[model samples]
Target: MNEPIISVSGLRGVVGGSLAPDVAMRYVAAFSAVAPAGAIVVARDSRPSGRMLASAVHATLCALGRPALDAGVAPTPTVGVLVRRLGAAGGIQISASHNPPEYNGLKLFGPQGRLLTAAEGEQVLAQYRHSGPAWVPYDRLGGWQEIEDPLGPHLDAVLSVVDAGLIRSRHFHVVLDANHGAGGALGRRLLEALGCRVTLLGEAADGQFEHPPEPTAENLAGVGAAVASAAADVGFCLDPDADRLAVIDEAGRYVGEEYTLALCVAHVLADRRGPVVTNCSSSRMTADLAQRFGVPLVRSAVGEANVVSAMVQCGAVFGGEGNGGPIDPRVGLVRDSFVGMAHILAAMARRGLPVSRLVEELPRYEIVKTKMTLQRHRVPAALDALEAHFSGARADRLDGLRLDWPDRWLLVRPSNTEPIVRAVAEAKTRHQAQELCDQAAQVIAALG
Candidate 1:
């Protein structure tokens, strides 16, 4: 069997190929070995393979004499909420997020309802490598229990943070493209509670995708037309686990995942100003939003766990990635698509502006991303050459090689799972951003 992409957070790969039942069992055993001794909450998305993988996970937990609280067909954030709400030792969400249907994986959360920190993840990885599952006698085997209302706590948590009444008063019409992910049920309920007339697409929790599954501009080709025809005020698109969201404007324009965080930060900082945190790879428009609110903006290494760590360290009021996954401590520590939806609705209601106008008012930026294949031995020289070429720009090695200018920036990062280097550049205009990437590409090509 091929190896899955294993990390401290969890592992993901092709369902029956790289990721198999035994792999999930050993991974869960590793988590259970390190996790505090208490009942664990296990939730999953609507993926078809989730059921089979979840059975293996449950069996492993039971063999370890660890109780399992099965939260069937729930989103990733919901697992976090459930873990904390149930006071469990930890949580495991069987999801591949936005990956295609043939893929599946597990995301582990600590007892505090957050992704495991780097230190914690390291211990789990070590445990998985050296020690195997500690199976117990039948008499000592733990049992599983199905959760009755898996979505309730998460819904209440998301609704409580935003001005629900204000959003309801607006009577906004919304088009939610759940894309047959685990979040469809909760997405529909939350939208209706906010008094929005919802036009739900692929709301089933069956892992059957109507689109390419990733909620990107290119993938969500026809969704905007549906929003326009429904005469909806806005459109919301969610990935498989519903942890990430992408937006569509009132004009049926794809506002994209990057603006999801910026718009939320814009609305949140206005209500309660505090430090903001985002990954290094996120758009700089959020930094401008933080400045507009006179709050500090801190950028951490690229990853959701790293962003959460920075948020906790800084006590950030709002933080998220450019991938439409917003983390609001007011809701829960996990990247929450529901919270993003609510806050965006609140922003629209409070500003009394169309989504398009709100997006227009924000600072403009274009980020272009491209990658090149190179041997691992050549990565350093390529990075050095790019850094030397862009000598005038400020450099930061926080996550990768990032070159910063007054109004433009460039990032060249090697992929964690591939023998490739990705170059991302952002500027005032698409032409400028593309030019930056082009320049970096030329420098990297020189190393060849």
Candidate 2:
């Protein structure tokens, strides 16, 4: 039997291979066993498999006599917002994030409308592994309800964070590439509300992806070219789940995902002076921005849940990961593409400059990411060896072995979603970053 990749947050795998209808039902049953008592909200991206999985989730919830609030075909962040707005006990989003079309998965949210923390997720996983479905009697079965106007509340929340009137007056010509995900619906609404002349791509929520699902530099080349060809002031690209965003300048430059967080931090710090947070894997641009405002910047382990956990602990004003995900506690805890888009437009309007110019104002660095396979048991020894090898640099063992220099840093950590150890390095020069990764990889290889 094929086993699905399960984590504290949720599970993802190829549909028939590991994520079958039974698997979905069983996971939802496990979730129902532990979720807070009340209604549970359900949402999904544009994946073709979403409907099937949604049905399984709904059935499982009904069997457990838990009300299922269905928010049909919405972004992942929308589920988070609805969980809070409707006072639901929990929420489940059916999305594989930026994975290829063949992949689909579930992301669990707690009552606070945020992804489950490591502890909370572990509880659910434990229940999932041990408990069988407790089917309620026929008369006690739960009912289903549809969420009408699902995007309105989320739209209002996003618009409130930016200078809507100022952005409206600028009438910036913008390009949005939703890539046939749930984002296009709200992306169009948000952009139009900000008074931009919008050129939308893949506006339908049919799950037919036009390009690679991930919004990386290589995947966004066509999007950048489209931005240049459209003669727009800027372009925004969203993953299939619309939780992440990538930027494309008017000159067809792919700004990548790191700038999404830095640019938003810059805008937020301009008005509010408070603590900021990001995962360790994020670029240092946000750190520089926080320093410019004389506010503290904190780094958590690499994951949205980890970042949100630290943000809550530190009372952060804004926080997010580097992969085009920005979390504003004001809107919601989930990583929101809409929040990133609105803040970016607000930054552009506030600076009265092109997207590229705004990006140039931030401290610049080159980051290289590489990964290698290693048995789990050997990870600690490898980290110890690395720490000794780079003994001269500042060492941190928060999530992994992180060695930092005055102008560069390297993080070698195991992946939460895969079996490989990911090595990420950032420096003033690309060569330096690549060299660090190469050295680390060699060390791990020799240890193996």
Minimum summed lDDT over a 10-residue window in model 1 is located at: 439-448
lDDT of 1 at 289: 90
lDDT of 2 by residue, 1-448 (tens): 6888898899999999988999888888888888889999999999999999999899889989999999999999999999999999999999999999889999999999999999999988888888888999999999999999989889999998888999998999989999999999999999999999999999999999999999998888888889998899999999999999999988989998999999999999999999999988899899989999999999998889999999999999999999999999989999999999999999999889998999999999999999999877788999999999999999999998889898999999987666789999999999999999999999988974
User: Which residue pairs in model 1 clash with each other?
Assistant: none
Name the runs in model 2 displaced over 4 angstroms. none
Per-candidate RMSD, Å: 1.0, 0.9
Which candidate gets the maximum lDDT versus the true structure?
A: 2
lDDT, candidate 1, 58-79, per-residue tens:
9999999999999999999999
Q: Which ranges of candidate 1 are over 4 A from the true structure?
A: none
Instruction: Give the backbone clash total of model 2.
Output: 0
Clashes of each: 0, 0
